[model samples]
Target: MKTLPALGDDARVRLSRQGGFAAIHALSRPREIEFAQCDISQRTRICSVLEGCLTLDSTVSGRGDQRFYQIEVNYRSGGQEDRMVLKVPEDQAPGELVHLWDTGQLL
Candidate 1:
């Protein structure tokens, strides 16, 4: 599984060759993890949120005779930048992840 960090307010979207996709969002604090499975034909979409700016990890695998691909997102405070890592099949292209930080002041 590959891991990456979500930077900024932009949402990160990943697509799989088997018609699967995953979206992730990063928060300033640690939060509860939520997951839901679907019965779509050959396609699945999963989402996860991190409450406290921290590492975000995710795993994607094909159901019924499939390999597993992993992803991780690392969020760091004090630094002005975010970090991300990607691990996927050699036959597949790289995925994109976004990172964003809170301004601390609310509107």
Candidate 2:
């Protein structure tokens, strides 16, 4: 379980996994994004500019195998629902999942 700094105000937070699976929770809302073995060759990425609250669910899986080799994130916010799916290769390292909430800002 990895915890990222809160995203500005409004009780928002971000989290990610390195080589396994990870989940994120805000209050009671839950959302997710993941990177799997098959994702090795595929590039999985996310970018968000929030006007309100944004929630997402993403999954990455290995090819040929029905079971995803890895599960990365699950997150939820205080708003409507949004979802995304990405396919990646099995050689990519999981470290790629780490990303700054607001890239333009300095920590």
Give all candidate RMSDs, comma-separated. Answer: 15.4, 13.6
TM-scores of all candidate predictions against the true structure = 0.20, 0.23
What TM-score, to 2 decimals, does candidate 2 have? 0.23
How much is 89 displaced in model 1, in angstroms?
12
Displacement of residue 47 (Cα, Å) in model 1 is 5.6
For candidate 1, lDDT tens digit of each residue in 2-58?
322433233232322231343322311222111212223211222332222113322
C-alpha lDDT values of all predictions: 0.29, 0.27
Writing each residue's lDDT as its tens digit, candidate 2 over 1-107 gives 22222221222223322222332223212233232321323211232322111222224443333222122223334453322223223243232332232131212
Error (Å) of candidate 1 at residue 93 is: 20
Whole-model lDDT, model 1: 0.29
Clashes of 2: 23
